[model samples]
Target: MNVALWIAAGLLAVVGLVGGALKVVTPKAKLAAMRGGEWTQGLSDGLIKGIGVLEVLAAFGFVLPRMLDIAPVMVPVTAVCWMALMVGATVTNQRVGQGKLAVATVMYLAIAAFVAVGRF
Candidate 1:
């Protein structure tokens, strides 16, 4: 279970880092032009950046606390936050008619839920 939790968290961290970094660095226009990025069209730049920041933070939260042997409770908390973020992503994708992206977020949400339940 521990190994599985670590694997899940690692995967989540990698995704959060990559996705968040892209959101932070990419311009709104570019993101909106991307295939799965149409959802950004309905959001403000600041909100997008804010979500990116949260994602980066959640990435760290998923690993750092437990790895450092500190407040390991943060792992599950991060999982919950990731779940919420994924839910929002799912809804936003659905609104933009990005069914594929919505399905992807659902997969991520499932992974987060698995990590949350396993860690808790």
Candidate 2:
């Protein structure tokens, strides 16, 4: 169980890092992809950038604090935050009729939940 927890933690950390990097580097393109051919026009760039920054911060929260044994609470906090974000994503995608994205969001949320439970 400890091994499983560590593995899940590592996987989620890597995913958060990579996803955040992509969000920061290619917000427009990624948003487009997420929207499934729908234009993200009228959406505030600042909002997108904010989300990107948050994602990166959450990514760091998932790993750095735990590794340093400093502010270890951040790990669980990050998991919870990611879980919430995934839930939001799932709802948003479903409302937009993007079934695949919705499914992906659910998967992410599940992973986040698993990490949370395992760690706790």
Off by over 4 Å in 1: none
Tens digit of per-residue lDDT, candidate 1, span 1-120: 899999999999999999998899988999888877779886899999999899899999999999998999999999998999999999888898999989989999999999999888
For candidate 2, write residues 4-55 as lDDT tens digits: 7667777777777776676677767567776463424445767666666777
> Lowest summed lDDT over 10 consecutive residues: which window, candidate 1?
34-43
Q: Could you give the C-alpha RMSD of every candidate to the true structure, in order shown?
A: 0.8, 2.4
TM-scores of all models? 0.97, 0.83
Backbone clashes, each candidate: 0, 0
Shift of residue 63 alpha carbon in model 2, Å: 1.3
User: CA lDDT, every prediction?
Assistant: 0.92, 0.75
Candidate 1 versus the native: TM-score?
A: 0.97
